[model samples]
Target chain A: MSTLKNGIVCSPAIHAPGEREITFSQAIREAVAEEMARDERVFVIGEDVAEAGSVFKVLVGLLDEFGADRVIDSPISEAGIAGIGVGAAITGMRPIVDIMFGDFTTLVMDQMINQAAKTHYMSGGKLTVPMVLRTTLGASRRSAAQHSQSLHALFSHIPGLKVAVPATPYDAKGLMKSAIRDDNPVVIFEDKMLYQQKGPVPEGEYVLPLGQADVKRAGEDITIVATSSMVYTALEAVDKLAEAGISAELVDPRTTTPLDTETLIESARKTSRALVVDEGYQQYGVTGELAAVIADGAFYYLDAPVKRIGAMNVPVPFSPAMEDLTIPSADYVFETAKAMCG
Target chain B: MTETNGTKQNGAELDAEHWLQAYEQMVRIRSFEEAANELYTSARMPGIAHLYIGEEAIAVGMCEVLRQDDYITSTHRGHGHCLAKGAALDRMFAELLGKEAGYCRGKGGSMHIADQETGNLGANGIVGGSAGIATGAGMSIKLRGTDQVAVCFFGDGALGQGLLYESMNMAQLWKLPVIYVCENNQYGEYTHNSKTAAGSMIGRATGFGVHAQGIDGQDIRTVYSTARLVVDRARNGGGPAFLVCNTYRFRGHHVGDIDRPYRTREEEEEWAKRDPLKLLEDWLTKTRQADASVFERIQQDVQTAVDEAVNFALEAPFPEESEVERHVYA
Candidate 1:
């Protein structure tokens, strides 16, 4: 029950004994359904969200449960729909707008950045856009440059927007609920690769605060600060590092905007060596920011300079062979952490 | 003066009282813009101000038919719409003056004033920016099952923006209670609409299966009568409608653009002869609704109010430095 400076609980007891398991997509659907049931103001609006249940099928049964009024389909107009989400949110409804892929975020940037992100502040807090833009992030599906890109870092850089990058089913459900209930505009970047990944999710209701970081594995040798899909990769590297006699602590910053710098720096200080990992591009990406934070906060305690592992600063290639080389893998993190520890 | 009954003349079915109110609102918008122009030209007001001088009738006419709870999204040249939508004169001037008592506490300045109580979503700085917001408000109204409609006020320049077409398409498809008011003010910033927009404005909306109409923006009666029909249609679940108001911008784009080389002086002189205020006043007099004395009194009252509002803004304090970090998140 420990809380940080912003009153963010370090770790909530989300998992109960023998909790039911669900896929990441199922958790997302459950979260949206529960929210719509809890508040009549909450509804889903996006292309293919109604009958198609979204292109990724993450929202499979929402239409039948919520009906067409709440689970509405929209034209393939990203800016228009995102703007509708903002206008509706400010007026009275909590709209959950789904962008099919992370790359499509380019089409809605003006609405998200200019209208949604700046409304509250520009209106002097007289108005609030309580909306959530749910989109997918992550590469490696061989969807190529336009379809395959992790653009969470671009949104996190904006001041008013709260960016969430949940790494597990438990975090996804909990974070989605919190985002629906939040009064500020929030963007949730779900890694497409983790949609079908199964994990334990609790039956009872629970909400994870956006700014809190979760320590997946506690260690003392080197700290691995990862986000979204990279959290699992970092965990896999942690197991491999342990076999090599290296105790690596892994941290998942669930939300990037309201970042839990306290937990990240705490872990880095404890381990005295840190390596940041993310699927976003390396240049001006999330890893560079986290590395800078850890480097500054744990500067005196570090054994070596903090290292960063992000997607190679090149367009995601269409070929699987070339795409495989672009994204970071368990071997890359293991090798980087080992080198830092050495 | 040609004698005619007030109700049936000039295509307006409004009573004498409604016509008077519309005239006053148009005059108020003109006075407000004049005051704002004075502030900018005299080096008193900070930042840029887009005068809604010649386009006043469109805003006043459209808003005359709207209820207090109905929503409106405005554009960079939005002072007229905000005033017509019932924004207080003091707060409007205060915002333009960067005062703490402004609608946005001086943060929004002239182009970003938003009043939630008045259902003014905001005056956006970006051209064609509020089309989606207005369409979204309509979607919210539909989802909530409310009878209230949302009006999106933009210049003909916005017709060139893709978001407007996208919003219009969705609005028509979903049958959302939205009224897209395109004030075709002859020019888009410095360029004429002919150079910027290819097709007709009404054609763009009708292409999306939306009910579209174009009317004389200078005549307050025509503007009001058309707006009333469109707003009532949307409110009664008749779906979205596109209203193209053929108007002109009398002044330069902003107060600073004094020499408007983009447009000819002959054209300005031509449109000036059909000033919205002059047209309304002439109609009111000819219909025997109100005499010159009444129009003079209205002008005097508006001038006093504008003077007081300007003084209030001039005397108001700037926001505290600490407020800069506030309101970034709700």
Candidate 2:
């Protein structure tokens, strides 16, 4: 079976028979460790990556394993870090550059969008900028507006970049490994909230392809398309919807760039209704794009208009209550899904 | 590569060989850029073309000191640097014409030209764009344990850019094998460097303690000598050097920009007094490296080369519309 449709093991700890549970952090660590062990050319560079092993601790123990030469700690220069990553990538090194926060992508936009994205095409296919710009994005930790953002849509819009948003531990490790090996520039948006979320990942060498979507729950009433941390929220909403006699299918798009429109279209066609959910701003975001694609692909099969449920249009505030108000909750998802089903 | 006597100041006693190479490179740039200007004026090439008219000496000086394997990242006004770093004439011309045979396969024109084989990272359209790249190349060299030094060429306008400061700091901290060559060509688009910049360009480097120095970029010998010391130091694991070469742009910021609104004719005339070509020609004649006939011969050769490039570009095929989508991914 294709890795995209891998059987979702419910409750990572309550694994079936011989399965093992792993967090999103452990999966990513294993992926990096495996890739580093496999290829001597691969290395990680970012702020606090060496001694600290990154602020999120996703790269813990890597410095000891790979040594400082491979796991470099960069200064707080987003543009420089990005440019250095590009330069090293085109020359020889397979660099996985962590930008710390997705909000800082604005600071390094010239290098990421202008230099890294355009290098391969600008060089007449004579050079390949094979690298991954990894960043953690979300508003759960109350990082406020500056530190939290879901700007994968901005990167996905760029022609030369491949955007990957892995919402599960299984997909995170597999997709990261795949991104590292791929010969084009890839941007991996890791949700900060899902780092501790547990799931079963294969022990041996495994890789998941980009631009693939996974169906968590199969239902006939309505298909709920969710991204990143919102996937779990959709699963929660699915459970709630089922209690109310509304069978809602949960579709998690692993990679949002080469968006898995086919699977979504098929699901929308079958269910005859769709609800797109994301943590990004609803005005111009992944939900908006996916909703359009779903409509274009299966417009006639639709029982009602496509609904886009996302964060309220406001910067993620500091207070827990205010932040909670801004973020989409399970109740919100249930209400949207219920309305669609009704 | 014969060395001049240490006794001669600024290599004034240079031989005919060095004179012709320097003279030829400068002539090549002057001729090529003149052709590009005419092409833009005639509407043959339709894009913003930043010509490197008066900044030939800096590119030639830096490239001469660098080996073919060494890397150099350039700015938008980078045709001179590409030619100096051994970019193919026909390919560059083809790129400017948006033909299939171009350096960017016509995907990138004048502002975005890159020669990978020759180690020209790219001519970035963004100001101060090459700093991080050059530093990264230095990191690669250090990791690979190679003696290859990376040189980044940008204008004086880039001196105010934040990336330059960050890159210089990193280069100093790690002692990366990189050379930061700032060709301060007086203007960053329309504003004068003095009007926009607060302090000296050399201080930008010295503050980081990166062995900074300033020079008259019109004098090719001084430019070459300073670059040689810096490049040699980096190759031998000395560290990064931030050398500021003060040059002037005889042309406007771009092909079509008439600088009458921002700059003055008198000021242009004043700076033209120390034109790099004249300085080199005067030195060559005084040193008896070449007579009038030899100068004419070298100019003729460069003219012929430029003419050949134009013809090749004119005859080259434009990229197919279907192929436009190609290379966007890889």
Candidate 3:
């Protein structure tokens, strides 16, 4: 078994051995594979999951490894898929359901919102549903508005759910592991752009606890809180801002709900300024909620008004330049932080 | 596969015990509903109560075929279901009164009454919601290798729900040991069945490959026999069956609809004339089977039982306010 170690960890065979390199897709595949092997109840079900693997090839070779039953290739029915998973989970099965695209979650909103989220409470706590719903969100490939929407904000608004939007390979593996094991229903939003990006991931089984924020970079002039693909954008913008001599602290909230609001609050209290970044639509987006939480939770510490950066209050257009203009970018984060600090 | 002789045992051979049980249940339901109506109109009860006055025989006939441990899923029209499933009158009455001593600690009122020991899953208020849940219960039984059967009680209006179709298909696909009992009370709320339903009820079940039948629900004997055959088949692993009990409601959908003009008096009178309670009574008296003294004794017994239940409920205390957040998580 090829073992790869980073920092202080060691485990079985990884595609990237002895190298501090693992693609985002490889990280996800490793997490699901290890989890399914560890737990008897873990199984994957989604469209094109078996014979063709996943559309993004993140689930490649899983069908051959786990057989057809565990890696189910379901019919193209999102509602039925989600509904069956809800039933299965309530009846003592842990299903890792894939909705292919985050946009298609709208088709199964009733199953997600009504059944999975409320069954435990509505049944007067007679049931405990353990299931992880994985969907790819965000757009950097010009997939257009229909296939490229970031709707995690909608799911985060729900109370009974736990939302995880991982930004890097290490966080992807760790957060996915945490999500799979969490008792509550978890929606793991994986950005499409981050899938092919490479980063250092530990070789062995690890769980990055949900509801904790990671300080990706440490600086005291300004605080930048970003999620999903925007974390990379924030890091890039920080590099350019460093050349321009504007030091900043960057925080990546690996999970949204049960958000690491404490970390963001502490950082805002120290820096006295915050720039919220997200890829969702402008109104009622994650940035708006984070800004509000900061305003209410740590208003006295703020030296300047909290700035928000998100997609335009419109659909994500198809053109490359327009798409960049639409979604919050590192340039946007940098610009907003600069203006706030100035 | 042992076969016994289908011999006739006096007039009782035609199910005298079963009919007697049905009559007892029908009588109990009628008295209970009447008492609830009187109490509700007087504002004695806590919440809106859906009386099962006009739909007595369906629950009685269906429950008669079920063993004490066999499960049944009820709807908002659940008083008859709880009573038929052998739930304690005191607990049920206490539940209706939102008392602490009630079945669900009075949290689940009339629509959500439940008695787990009796295998009466809580009465759901959502249309067709119980179908899949009952199917899940059947799955639970099958997985545990038990002979227990789950009876899903749904209104005719539930037939249009997709979960109904999805559950029916799943039940048939697995040959789940269940009985899908559709209580066709002729109306869904204010709308007539003719206006809402598509095709025949039997057709809907048969289309899903379940053995389907419809019986005159007002007649306890017919309901008992048909239910016995279907329920027995299910118990012995013959898969699920759909039995649509054709019946009617004598009173308005709820207690307050005294002036609704949706249906004619002729229709109501036609159904009321064949009330399951009177049908059993006529059969019993005509055959000189039960005397006026016996009937009076039965009436007194049921009335006393209902009175004791009401008194118990009235004396029962309300649940503590702290219990609200207690059951939200397991």
Number of the predicted model whose DockQ against the real structure is largest: 1
lDDT of 3 by residue, B1-330 (tens): 112224552224554454565677888999988888887899998777777876787888788878887888888888998899998888888888888788877767788776667877667777766676677566556654679888889888787777777767667876778788898988888899999997788999899899999988788767777877888998889999998988887888788877659999999888889888888787777665665666677788999999999998998888788877665433
Q: What is the CA-based DockQ of model 1?
A: 0.86
Candidate 2 residues A179-229, lDDT tens each?
Answer: 999888899999998899888776777788888888877889999999988
For every model in order, the fraction of real contacts preserved is 0.80, 0.77, 0.11
Tens-digit per-residue lDDT, A1-342, candidate 3: 332222112233323445567899999999999998998677887888888889999999998898876887766767656655665565556788899999999976766776667655544455556788999899767888889999999889886778999987888999898888877789999999888888777676678899998877777888888899888788878777777788888888888887998999988888888888888887988999999877777789888988888888878789997887887777777787788878
| TM-score for each model | 0.97, 0.96, 0.82
lDDT of 1 by residue, A85-203 (tens): 99999899999999999999999999999999999999999999999999999999999999999999999999999999998888899999999999999999999999998777778
Q: How far does residue A320 in candidate 2 sit from its true spot (Å)?
A: 1.2
For candidate 1, lDDT tens digit of each residue in B56-137?
Answer: 8899988988999999999899899999999999999999999999999998989999998889999998889999999989
lDDT of each: 0.91, 0.87, 0.79
Docking class of 1: high
RMSD of each: 3.2, 2.6, 5.2
Q: lDDT by residue for model 2 over B1-330, one digit each (tens)?
A: 233334567755556687689889999999999999999999999686888888899999889888889999998999999999999888999999999999998988998888878999999889998788889889888888889999999998887799989888888888899999988888888988879889777887888889989998989999988888899998988899988888889999898896447888898899899889989887777655566788898899889999999999999999988877788776
Q: How do the candidates rank by DockQ, highest first?
A: 1, 2, 3
